[model samples]
Target: MSDWIDEIKSQLPAGRVLTDLADRSSYSFDASFGQYIPEAVVQAKDKEEVVHVLKVANRWKVPVYTRGQGTCLSGGPLPVHGGIVLDISQWPREIEVKADDLTVVVSPSVLTARIDEEAAKHGLMYPPDPSSAHVATIGGNLAENSGGPRGLKYGVTKDFVLGLEVVTPEGEVIRTGGGTIKNVTGIDMTKLLVGSEGTLGVITEATLKLVPKPPEVQTLMAVFDEVRLAGQAISKTLTSGVLPSKMEFMDKACIRAVESFYPSGLPTDAEAVVLVELDGHPEALEVEAKLVQDVMEDIGARETKIAQSKEEAQEMWHARKQVSPAIAQIKPTKVSEDATVPRSKIPEMIERLRGIKEKHNVEIVVFGHAGDGNLHPNVLCDQRDQEEMKRVEDAVEAIFEAAIELGGTLSGEHGIGTMKAPFMERELGKVGVSMLKRMKDAWDPNGIMNPGKIFPEEGQKLVLRDE
Candidate 1:
């Protein structure tokens, strides 16, 4: 292994290959749980470097885990098999906004939000705005097919991607899709790799489609006496033929946490708050805003507050954005699970989360894009407490089961890195899992690309505590 690593060193630029235990330790883990030190760390800055690393890794049958900003919540970048961590975060940021074509070409290392920032100059927008867009690299977002609040109106990363430059598991550089808006030519490899979690190949560059930026936007907040009512409000608003730009939800625990963490004007006494944003023409927004307000009230909302000023609206969104950090302040560790259900089942999912929390004795905070049914049911706890963590694990499993039972998915935006691998069979079934395995085996015959992820091993279970 050391010999092959040495060979990888000789191919790349000086100091590009890091052999120091301290450096490898840095690439060992990501924002998710679990850690495994890699045998080496490759700070690949260009496509050639990526090709070189993959070629050497494939030849030696060494596992290669491609990583970006490491903001993955599903252990997407964790080097579980201990081979190499190809760190691409430091790769030069490159973003070229083709305003005329309503598209953008970007290097994998570019920050996801930066693409939108550049697109804004041309009155265009990149709609897939993940919560970590400002920090997470586009490469990672593409890998996880991450989604944010805007995903309610627009789609996830897979929907916006026009094409991709991927380094195959065998180290061959291949291009998929094109800059055009529509292309039915051959297999859709671009979509295939977008959410594969870096198991199939390594993404070096991507061409993304952008949309016209909405000129005006309005914000509305609906206060509910019960969390279930807030869920109903989301379904009601969407079914009212008033598709909001974003519809977010936060439970009582999340509301209080955000207020305490940032001292926002949120009503901490409310059982839940459904924050809504409408975009497009100002006049049309006013009309749609009223309709949304009516639906909220009819759905049993105690009160509905429409922001009169931009600052007020921003303050409302800022509170919503503060949910993750706010909840983090409540506990040392957060088992953030994005088990999404049908839009109609948001209330039922909330009910299930409450029951699971009570049954497992875990402190669970529920929130996320309610309009699309991609809810973030986070279990807050201390990882140091083994007994509590065991409960948390059970609670997490129950949440996934509930979502799947309701015709939802194991993950909405978060990839099934390691946390959800154990249950892949439960959702995909034996045949489906076997078909996916065949595809993976065909792509990476040596099984050297992001091993021990997505597909579970013989006996892989969710373990959060440091055992």
Candidate 2:
């Protein structure tokens, strides 16, 4: 270990190799509750530094994990293998907006919201707005192919990423895609690496495509007597020929949690609430808002309120964002699952989640982007309680199984990190799992880039045997 550290330090700038236990501990885990201390942390400033570290790791046959801002919810950046963590936050910060091409080239460390703010100056917008957009780096967003509320109408991060400057496992720099709008020359390597979760390669820079900013925006909050009613209302709104920029749902458990935290006049007794936003022309927004109101009323909405101004819309959205932190106050730990189904199956999916909670005798606070049918059903519990933790794990497994059973997927935006790798084969059949393994082998033959993550090892024991 000393020899390897000395070699890395000799290759890079002074103080680049971090072996201090305190600093190493900080980079061990992400937002995930699961923790694993990395052996060392390297703060690389440029692609050359990253290449040096990778070459050192390759020589020592040690695992290497790359991390951005460490805000990953899916344990994607967790260094469970006790190796080296390549921190990319020190990478160059550059943003170049080309008005002629309607595109932007940015470094990996650039924040998603910062790009949005920059693009706003040019009357353009990068529409992939994940909930963590405020803190998540563009590199992390591309690695996970992140999607948010706007994904319902605008699409995900993959749709905007036109090119990427990446470093392969062998420390070779490669460029996939370009600034052009159309490219069919060869394999779409850009899309393949977008959601690879750092397994394929490390992203150093990205060229993102931007669209013109919308003119008008309106937000509406509709309270329903039943959770399914709000789901049905979402389908009705989509079928009404009015595309919503954002559509989200929060159950009564989530509503009360947020109301207690904020006291924003949320209905505590309502079974569910659908928060919808439409962005476009002012004349079209007014008509769409009215149509949404009528659709909510037709679907048995108890009360409906439309934001009269931008401030009002922001207030409504802020209330929705408070659900996660507010629920954390009720328990020590929260196991949030990003299970998604077809837009039309949102009602049934929510119903199955309720059934799992009852069967396992656990509390689940449900909320998420209903426009894309991506629901976050969180299981709240104290991790110290042995029995409760077991039940929580069981309930999570049941949720995934139920999701796959209902023609839904195991994850919508959150990648299959360590938490969901055990059931990868269940969702993807034997052949599909084998194909993924082949891809992993083809990308990183030594299995050094985030090992024991997205793919399950052969003959590996299940994490929860009882479940």
Best by TM-score: 1
Q: Superposing every Cα of model 1 onto the true structure, what RMSD results?
A: 1.0
Clashes of each: 0, 0
What is candidate 2's CA lDDT for residue 205? Answer: 92
Put down candidate 2 lDDT per residue, 220-329, tens digits, no spaces: 99999988788889999999999999999999999999999987788999999999999999998999899999999998999999999889899999999999889999
lDDT of 1 by residue, 90-194 (tens): 899999999889999999999998999999999999999898999999999999999999999988899999999999999999999989999999978888888
Model 1's TM-score against the true structure: 0.98
Residue 96 in candidate 1, Cα distance off native in Å: 0.8
Q: Model 1, stretches more than 4 Å misplaced?
A: none
Candidate 1 Cα lDDT to native: 0.92
